[model samples]
Target chain A: MQGYIVKRILIAAFTVFTVLTVVFFVFRLGPADPVMVMLPPNATPQDAENLTKKFGLDKPLMVQYGNYLKNAFRGDFGSSFRFDEPALRVLLMRFPATLKLGLVTFILSVTVGLSIGLISAVKPDSIIDRIGRLFALAGMSLPSFWVGIMLILFFGVTLRWLPIAGRGTPLHYIMPAFCMSLYPIALITRLSRSSMLDALKSDYVVMARIKGVPEFYVILVHAFKNASIPVITVIFGIFGALMVGSAVVVEYIFSWPGIGRLVMESFFARDYPVVQVFVIVVTCMVVTLNLIVDIIYAYIDPRIRYQ
Target chain B: MHSNQDNLLELQDVTTTFFTKQGEVRAVDGVSFSVGKGEVVGLVGESGCGKSVTSLSIMRLVPQPAGKIVSGRILFKNEDLMEKTAEEMRQLRGDRISMILQDPMVAMNQLLTVGKQLGEPYKFHDKVRGSLREMCIRLLEKVKVPAPESRVDDYPFQFSGGMSQRALIAMGIANNPDLLIADEPTTALDVTIAAQVLKLMKEIQRETDASIILITHDLATVAQICTRVIVMYAGRIVETAPIKIFYKNPAHPYSVGLIRSVPVLGQPVDRLFSISGQPPSLFAMPKGCRFAPRCNKAEKKCFKHYPPETWLDENHSVACWLYPGD
Candidate 1:
């Protein structure tokens, strides 16, 4: 198990390296130039050259790439051209907000999704099951931006019961977080429902019932653990995506000061350092989350042995 | 066949039905039988013969909404199980009655330790007060699982098929239930392992004096441990007799066919004796004897009407037209 974990970390490091390299080259090859974005429109060619030299942009691409890799290894991603501060520092500042939003969204979706899914599975084809299924269908198909707008209009404009946008008090998180959680909630509900249905029908579940376990205990303790395995994979994937700023649209709409919005604004401003650092961070989060999921699988199912 | 006072469990015309998309299908139709105290009754039948369904009915664990005990009484210790509330059944289950399912490989929760699964009966029934782990180990040791102390902590996947069967047996008898239902407990094991499991069950039964209803398609298994045999065909009992009479002078044609089908060792034949034709479908059952279509001796009367149970002796009965009256 220790060897397996070590191997996973090595692979994750390699994956982050590969992603950083690709993002670095992609940004360099793009039409947008950080030097141009930094310079005034009437600046002279000499001024441009001097400015390029100042930022070490006049060097060969290979040399620049080497320097970028070396500095990145030392946790010294250069200052954001837009923020005029260390890009890693800027990203880190936004990290907590995103992490909080991700965690809240995760907990919200998991509880609601798993509850509906479990209820639907336990009493399939009933009124509540049908309603839950309908909710899942709408949640999965509706665009998040649309859902966010609808929520804003309903609770913010029409009802005037809550704040419309931005992160502050817990109430401000309600609209954006719920909007962002819809897809995952729907996905988890569907996956968990089917998985639970299968688990409930399994021989072990029947054996538990025959053992005279209370119905609730049989469903929750005996069947739920087995059912949650597949759901956990999807859940972790969604959470990783959330952590990595995939909630850009919702964050943008809500004016939420999260890494997702930070990445978007940085990209438009030609803040290459910030964008590059964000990519690396996102890649690392995804890889780490995947490894965590694998480790969790070993605990949830004894049949899974990591050699 | 035993007196009511001595009977640990009695099924009086119990009929379990399943409501599927196709229609309502009677899985177990008007089945009546009894298991006396300390007796081991074998419920023998081919696949889809309602043997497993019968056991599930007794446990009140039949799959719900779609399947239910539509009619009849399941009397346990002279109490009607059919009349017991769901909560009452739950309390009775694992406390006084327990079941061992077929396919030991899949019959245990993979995520739980064997000890945890074994301790479930004690935990749920609250029958034992001491350390659950110690009791689980003792149960494992009783079932003859090697290295019970350490092995109890292992999961079901770590145990081999026979070992898993042993662990399941351990769990089944953990509460020392009054009635233990084992549904094809050894169907998934090798021949030798199957024999060992049967022997273990017999030993447990003797030690606990728990009446056992052993459900299996293999008559050889029945002969090894069963005191009485109840032969079923198409959700109905074809014959029921003491194991000795069942082997020596089986009455029903299906019973005779089943006995003949078991190949005797060292007796080489061109083809093993097999009862031909598939069992009737649940959707469109024959109006008469359910097994009439497959019975070689089936007459016009057999096809026109179902045969009622006819007594062959004081302790034996057969359902066949050939028996007539006395």
Candidate 2:
């Protein structure tokens, strides 16, 4: 098991390195110069030259790449032109907010999704089951940004139960988190519902019921564990997706000051270092998520012991 | 309730049906039998002949939204089980009755350790807490599982086919129920393992003196373990007799053909005996006797109306038009 984990970490490290290299090349490919983007409009060519030399932009591409890789390993992602601070430090500060949002959304989605899935599987075709289906449909159909706006309009503007935007108090997180969680929740609900339906029909469940296990234990303990195996895979996928995409729209709309919003601000300001660090963080997050998923799979399913 | 108060289980005109897009399928139709305390009763049938459904009905676990026990009663010790509330049934199950289904590979929850899985019956029905670990180990050890102390902590995947089936048997008898229904307990296993499982079952039965409902398609398995046997075809019981009598003199043509089909050692014939034609589908059952389409001795009247069950002797009965019906 330790060997399996070490192997996964090695692969993840390689993937992070590849992502960094790609981001480096892609950002440099753009016509914007880091020095000019940072300098005032009236600054002279001499000022540009000095700034370029200062930041080592005049150095050969290979040398610069090596330095960037070395500095990235040491937790130095250069300084953000806009923030006038180390890009890694800025993102590290904002990291907790994004992590909090992702964590909240993930927990909320899993609990609600699995519950509805189980209920639907138990007495399927009931009124509540139909409502759950429609709920899933609505969740899948609406975009997160549109959903976020609608939530702001209803819960934030009309009812005033929650603040319109921003992240601080517990209330501030609800609308954006709900908006962010919508699609994945829908996916989880649909996937787990079907998975649970199949599990309820499996022989073990029948045996459990035959053993005179109470209905709750049969459904929750026996059926739910089998059903959640596939659902967990989908959950990790959703978490990875939320970390990258939905958070951007949600953070932007809510002005939550998370990595997504930071990414947008840095891109607009052509803060290359900040953007590079952001992309690299996202790449590493996904790699780490995949590794966690593998470990969890082994734990949930006994058949998956790593040699 | 009958004068034979020793009967542990009695099914009276139990008819379980399934509603589908096609039509209503009578999976178990008018099936009635009685199992005396400590008697091993074998329910023998072909595939899709409602043997499994009969076991499920006895357990009150017919799948919902499609299958339903449309009529009749299940009497355990002269008390009608059909009248019990769901909660009461829950209490009765695992306490007075437990079932081990076929296919040990899928019969156990994969994620649970053998200890927790086998410990469930005692927890739920017996409420025997605090010594669950020891209880599970004892049950496993009783079933002759090797290294019971550590094997109890292992998951289903860690056990082999034979070992898993033994674990299932242990789980089924954990509460020491009066009746244990084993549905084809050894069907999923190969010959050697199957024999071992069967032996374990008989030994357990002898030790506990619990009544058993052995549902299987294998006549040889019946001959080995059952004291009484019921032969069914297409969801209806065709014959019921003591094992020796049933094997020696099967009145129902279907029963005769089934026995003839089994190959005996050192006996060679130009061809093995077989009942011709497929078993009738539940959805499209014949108006007359269900076995008439395949029975070589089927008469003209057999095609017009269903045969009423009749007792030919003091202890043996057959469901065929040839037998005189009162």
Candidate 3:
């Protein structure tokens, strides 16, 4: 167990390092002038140079990256050019909102998707199965942005049932969470349904049925528990994907102050420090989520529990 | 013949058909047999001879999409199994007639613990989760599992193939069912373990008074453990007789060939006997007795028409013309 944990942590750390290095170099590679962007338009060249030197961008690219890593180790993400605040501070301020959105969407998608998938599998030839397949198809085919717009137009514009955008109250969260959940919900449904289908027909299930276990209990307890490994893995992995993907469109559409919107704003102004820090933070979040998913896999399946 | 007094279960003209894309295939074609109380009736046949299908037909456990008990009356204690609803059949399945399948390793669920799997039947049948812990321990002990209390919690993989078979046997007999259908229960185990399990099953059967339907392709296994043996060829019962009568005066050519093919340990021979032909396909079965294609005593009548089952004695029957003075 210790060895597995250590291996995972090292992998995560290496991934974070690779992501930081790539983002730092990629931003630096752009011809955009960080010095000019930082300084006022009326400032003298000497003042621009001073500002560049203070921020340590005057150094070579490798040296600048090394300093960034050193500061990163000590919780020192440089100040955002636009916000005039520490990059770390901006991230910490915005993370909770994104976390809330992601968590709600993740929970909703997995629960609804798994239930529908199981229903579809259990009554395979019924209308419910057809409906589940259609839902899964729509979830996969429709882009999140288009789905979000459609949802807003239908629920917010026409029906006046939900807020179009922004995340403050519970009502503000519903549309964005629904939009973000689409693909994971679809993916999880298909995966769980197929796995459940396979599990239901297995010898063990027949054995369970022969033992006089009620049909519902056989499906819910024996088949579902056995089939869960794949669906859980898919859902957890999708959480990381959803977090990154939803951050931008959801943040923009909702006008929610989140790391996703921060990245978007940084993109428009070419704020190198903000962009690099945002990339690193998102990378860390993904790596951490993947680690947690791996741990969860082992926990749900005792066969993997090491001595 | 065993009178109706001892007959616990009987199947009359049971035919199981599987519908595939091509056509319907009669897997078990009008097979009939019975098991007496406390009797071990061996269904001995090579693979695809419908031994397993016959067992599944008796338990009503055949899966859908391909398999179904198309035509038959499975009489369990004078009750027509075909008339019972699936729910009704399910109730009688584990408590009254339990099954232990071939491939013991895959037969039991890999995910569930040995104890949970063993205790599951009791919980399902008895309707009370109380006493499950004690019941599980007792079952483990009944199946001869060592450290009954501690080892019960381990997964199927934790136990050896032999041990898993024992665990499966324990689960099958947990409800103390009147009939235990063991479908090649020792096929996956090594020789010694196979012997141990067969012995354990016999011992348990004697104690519990449960009739056993032992399904196997091994004639020697039937010789060792079965009280009566049914030799199936091409989804049809070619011969059935009491153990002593079967060995002393085997009537069916198939059973004789099968017994001769088994390598006897101390017998000197130029070469071991071999049944020379493959089993006929059920889809395009031969017109006569299914074994006539391979039979040394095949006659013109044997090739043109299927033979009626001829009674050799009160206790023996063979589905071949040669037995009735052809």
> In TM-score terms, which candidate is top?
1
Candidate 1 vs candidate 3: which has greater TM-score?
A: 1
Q: What is the DockQ of candidate 1?
A: 0.75
Q: Where does candidate 1 stray beyond 4 Å?
A: A29-61, A242-246, A305-307
Pick by DockQ: which candidate is best? 1
CA lDDT, every prediction?
0.88, 0.88, 0.85
The DockQ-based CAPRI class assigned to model 1 is: medium
lDDT of 1 by residue, B1-326 (tens): 65478888999999999999989999999999999989999999999999999999998888877999999998999999988999999998888999998899889998989998998888888767788889989989999999999998998888999999999888888888999999999989999999899888888888899999999998888889998999999999989999999999999999999999999999999999998998999899998988889989998999999988899788899889999867
TM-score of each: 0.93, 0.91, 0.89
How well is each residue in A66-144 modelled by candidate 2, as lDDT tens digits?
9888988898888988878998899999989998998999899988987787788888999878999999999989988
Query: Candidate 2 at residue A70, lDDT?
Result: 91
What clash pairs does model 2 have? none
lDDT, candidate 3, at A258: 76
lDDT of 3 by residue, B1-326 (tens): 43375688988889999988788788999988888888999999899999888888888878775789889888899889899997898789789999997777777777778888887788877645557888899889988889998998898888998998898888899888999999998899999999999899989988999999999988778888898999998899999999988888888888899888888888899988998889888778888888888989999999898888887877788899886733
lDDT (C-alpha) at residue B137 in model 3? 92
